[model samples]
Target: MLHRKNTKLINKLSTALFLAAITLSAPSHSKPVKNTSSPKKVVPAADLSAEDKLFVELREAAKVNDVAKTRTLGSKLESHDLSDYVLYYQIKPQIYDKGAQARVDSSADAAVEAFLKVNAGSAIADRLRNDWLLVLGKRKDWANFDREYVQFVLNDDTQVKCYAIQSRQAKGEDSKQLGHELKNILLDAQYFGEACPEAAQGIYRAGGLSKQEVAAMGRIALENNYEGLAKKFGVDDPIADTVKKARTDPAQAFREFEKKEWRTGRENTAAAWGVIGQFLAKKLDRNAIKAYRLQHEAGHHQLLSPESQEWKVRTALREGDWRLVKESIEGMSPAIRKRDPAWTYWYGRAQKELGDEALAKETFQALIEQFNFYGQLAREDLGMKIHVPKRVIPDESLVKQMSENKGFARAVRFYDMGLRFEGNREWNWELRTLSDKQLIAAAEHAKRIGLYDRAVNTADRTKAEHDFGLRYPTPFKESLSPIANSIGLDSNWAYGLIRQESRFIMAAKSSVGASGLMQVMPSTAKYVAKKIGMTNFKVSELDDMKTNLTLGSNYLNMVLQDLDGSFALASAAYNAGPSRPKLWREKLPRTVEGAIFAETIPFNETRGYVKNVLANASYYTALSSSKSPSLKQKLGMVSPKASVLSELP
Candidate 1:
């Protein structure tokens, strides 16, 4: 059934991709109906004449979606600026504009004016509001409307524009007015996050609000391990019983999850099981949790009814009692017998340990003959070095005895199982539903193990889905190969960098003023232009893939050179400016992998940025639409977030 589902998904994905390709490449449906495709008819913003501007205003009026005004506005605007693609998209749907969408929720005139006033107010239109949507689109009034929606705005006759109006009694900070407004705002944002920003802001300022009112905030703080804040706010006082109960009893914590109390469900489970696992793992031997993990790992209970045998085995295993191993291993389903040889082997060991010699003998014989893994262990027990058994044992119970023998066959079986069935045999993290990067990696790993069928399946899945393999019209080979060849860079490495920087979404922009494919800030681009002797350049040009790649790669080459050619060093330089790597190098641990990077990489953005880029590079190489770069070599450094710099430059 599992294989069948996966196969069906594969076909569906193929069909979906085919449909998407056809739709995206097709021509417009209404070229003749009104033919709005010509470059001249759709004049750019800068090219509109006075009459055109009136036409533009009428079109804009039409776009505002005021149905009553659409006919009037559309006729007036003959050559209006329609180049503001984003605004056009937003307004088109609402436009009663005399004509556009089939249905509109409100009057276009009212909605448009509301949108314009909120988005394009003087405060928003001027340099005051740095938000791009308002500055360019005259949408400053939109933010005001948001404020109005939250009831945060002062009524025209209310005379409380700046002061807190909730508490009408007093006006000063000492007055309850400030406290009330502040608390409400703070509560809104703190409890509801994005859902209640105005209230969040109120809560932020209401420093005097009681802990009871701040329960949500306090809970968030406590969950994040903010004990100090919890204490200061007295959040524990109101729900002291719940908090104390959570700390005292973990099974109780799981009850929340069981009851579908999702807010605390995951938190409670993690905290509960974390404690349980810690208690057993630290207090017991390796064999203790073997029975437990085996259930989560190997028990063949399909995840559909997850609480079945898998849950049962897990519960039994966490006990840390080797005595229960017998019951636990035997209790697993028969299907598990196919997947979990460890269960068979361990059962035999248990029988032997219990002094069941006759049963152990039968089990060991099979372990030696049928299961090649317990070869030496089985051989040692039986005291023979003869021909191999093609397929000896039929029953899983005998396989356990073979493992107890601890021969070559046992070792080989253990080795093979470690890679596949070692963990909870459920294959939860097994290569299913993997990302493009992950699937490719899984494919390579499967290939290394000679699992050609699995590897090809994984590779084929990635091949169809990964944009690295299928993007067209831009002749990837022509545009990207040189970048790869020049710096001994892999095509995928380049692709990863490009993907992260631009998503192949050429119009992307960063808050820090970075532009286009590589997210190069205009100033930085200008600096590069000057350094590289390139003239007449603009940040807008970064939208061009060829231009962006050239500049971004050149800058990368420079950073690499600065770092004496170490990829790790170069990557760090790219993220944290060129100088931070040296400072971090010294502050970090002297081990081959400097783990102090978590502390030394001061900027969270850059630290994560470096990790993401490196991870992306590794993924890109695996995609290998043409020839992939040597990834194992490049990724030789382990636990990337651990801050390891390999010997390679």
Candidate 2:
């Protein structure tokens, strides 16, 4: 999977040859260079405003864990109307350093309670409440845990959810409804850690989880390489042994699995088939054909977990076995069968292949309501044109209203001063009380102010009256399009990628120091500059739209050709690196649909990136073209690269 040579060679070739050919004659354009001048230093702490000096000292005291000093400083700041935060500084170290037990003993929970009483609706108070709940949960003080848990406003923490479920179960109140909800919450959890497994075990023992469910969960854990989790589930020895054996010799493992009672008992038989499906999916065994036949013939498909059944469909898809694909999709769980567009699209395809036009059209009709990647493909299936949603024009009155709002004004000021976190906080707080119409207005205001990312983010929160233009604006079209076109690349695709990369923030800089429009790495920019023969190129030039786009497009084109014309693979290579996608491709048993390939990628970040990029590209295509685009055509198919073992070290 190492792309060390490819990375180095790309840098060199991009800088040395590509730029050399065009740098001198490159068109000049006006793109803003961010002002990097250092800010003026504050006056000495001794001479600062009383509130400011106290704030500075309190922060330092908290950092060094000087509890006495923090308390003293906190007391002095009490009159400044910041007692809650000051109290937090004095108490935070006790919780962080010494453990929550001491904090509880020291009546730290009482201080948190007082803070919450005053700042009842604040995010900080909610956080402190969550922290205290964790301490109470640790102590197994279910009384206080139950009392405080109800007040924790968001109730979004997974660990807290597990603890809450466990507390409920301890009281012998594990209702069927509650158990089902808890099961859904923890179903695909990769690691149960401590709380979740404890909760799951209680649920399992209470008859909430059937034997089949336990085995399926165990298989999933083992497949995910979370052996500790598999052990936590306490699966039968045969299932556990099969999991281990399958890692080294799957065919032999299946043979061994068949000899056990797990293979025959009604409760265990379904899970046994699932385990075999999981194993054969990885192996891409031709025996999968027979496995599918058996799965259908025995009507065991209904028992397979969605994950197991998915692999069955994927395996069938890889071998281009249409009948199995149709059967497998039909046999999936109702939720998976009805809700997942991937399966739905393939199901429709399978129906068409089986000469059932009426069913195929019915399936395609349900998918076109949402304008996503699959929607585009579904539209093609129905012979309908793919057209972009109409742009929602900015309301000048709303823009003025947003501009006049004190909170948004503060956000603008903070953003102008390069305090993005504070700016974002203020912006979000302002948004908390706004109606959907007001939100659209705010998004428009954000767009006007060059905060395209924020605009898109804010717009994304609206559930009704979607504004596609606001969500998918192409701000740097004039500069970006030419570069993409010069490289014979689709401008829409490049824009979609840039939208995802930095959300059109011209001066955006990632934590890893990837700068500007494309988030190009400093090293990448330098190598590209050198390859293109830009003798005096400065790293700061990366912040300029014109330079960054040109270099980025060149590098993208290089990787595109290197990886082949498949945008799905090339996009993955772009985000990760060339060798990673190559390694991922080599793992596939045969050429499979790109959507299937994307779903199976190991890295969660890369998988999401590939899907979003493809989806985004499809949207952009519809936005720019009068004719409907085929997302499936863009995705194409992926095959294993030819074995080049001799070339590897």
Candidate 3:
């Protein structure tokens, strides 16, 4: 039943090697060395203007994904007029990266790993959870865990690989020794013809083999099972007795496992069931799964009867079975009055449906006030209009829309048209969810087209929110605060643009080839690379500190000049491409808000990008303790009566 995903992995490996090769060959274009200058010292914390210090520290903490420092610093920076990049990445970076720092906490990591099945990739079936890797490691460094894992994989050359596996052997967790010896034992057992190469002698010389430990481990599914696993490793039955005993008590074992308080046996059984689900006799497996799925689907399983209906409520809520979820929860016993912090939202949902309007309002109000994404969802269900993911990655048609059609290209046009028309009679936001496009690509397409409002709203609504915002918030700030004053470009406003443009993601790429922290186009980055008299530059590494900031700030500085020192015009130029923003002036009937007013902008991405920056500037202002720059300020809409083009020198 083990439907191995190994083949797909091989294909991906091939692609990665190919791309990495190209990236290496193209070295001259992306050598990120900005100057001959020494790495600048971070400014004296003593000299930072108080608000700048708070945000800088928050930004510094976010560089390493330090969540605690972010929260603490955010509390202090509350008065700074800064951008939301501090919150999106600084406060919660993984929410965007899908938690890809490859770090984790123990309990939550276990839950997420259990859900993910594979250790890591794009998070799917991945629930939001606090990392648990550190806790599971008892606060040990990940390198320790990596070392243990490496030993299991590469036992030979052990001395070169690491310190002697003396510790694991002494602790009797000698997986490396077992894996190495077991492999030799296996090939010898399965010898068809050729002699086997000597096994990689491990750092841990296998001490007196513990037949008992190997026997005990053999049947437990530790995967490192020394004897029976040797079957896969090609080992002869050193002790068939262990397998015999386990087989004899299989039913009793299942029962006993079901009874374990820690639910260990239940987990073993679930894995067995999962294997069965993958590779069983078709008729038998289908029938069993059909029965199980039917029970779960019909709302009639022991997992959720009247007495234990709360589980059913949670189950339905988790799967978003709204129609039945509300009914099931409300029907639960009145005795089950309280809810866990985790379960409180379901209670609120039930209350809303029971028409207990006031109580429902209060419960949800408190829920959202305390939590963020889900609370936002509940508040919106109460007519507050918060963004939430439906948790469905596009099935197929959406993939087609992004990959096969003019879907991505058209999306930009449609998006621009929509944003320009937002708050106008023609702006229609909901046309997209039904448009058979992946929301991520669709949002980018919207940005390309100039539907600023639509792009912002839709991007934030989907699980792909960061896809649109990832460019600016992430790498720029990480490197920005560390070297901002020296690198220059008001860090406060830089943070604002980073937040406003791509929510501060260095790697965020629009549908167009606008790349890096500042959304510099790939061509533009190439030119910047040449201008600074440095050679190597990989497009992907644009998120790296020195190159991204150097190019980004220079671009910003140039835009500022052309825009007559107007941050709004510069930002618009940044979004629309500076030349286009400038040329559009003579081409379009100028509104007071510049040629590309929210309603008139032709390129969707620049249009929405401009507005988002303005909105984000307001939020950033709130965070950075700077005066919130008004919308008119961003759109060149100042003095609603006066035209910017008329004032242009």
Scored by CA lDDT, what does every candidate get? 0.40, 0.68, 0.40
Alpha-carbon lDDT of model 2: 0.68
Cα deviation of 63, candidate 2, in Å: 11
> Which window of ten consecutive residues has the lowest lDDT sum in model 1?
123-132
Which of the numbered candidates is closest to the native, going by highest lDDT?
Answer: 2
Instruction: Report the lDDT tens digits of candidate 3 across residue range 20-65.
Output: 3221211112222322111221332464566666665665455444
Stretches of candidate 1 above 4 Å error?
A: 1-468, 471-476, 487-491, 535-545, 592-604, 625-649
Using TM-score as the measure, the top candidate is: 2
**TM-score of every candidate relative to the true structure:** 0.34, 0.74, 0.28
Q: How many backbone clashes does candidate 3 have?
A: 58
Tens digits of lDDT, candidate 1, 588-611 = 323232212321244546655554
Arrange candidates, best lDDT first: 2, 3, 1
Residue 338 lDDT in model 2?
A: 62
For model 2 the local lDDT of residue 104 reads 36
Which prediction has more favorable TM-score, 1 or 3? 1
Of candidates 3 and 2, the better by lDDT: 2
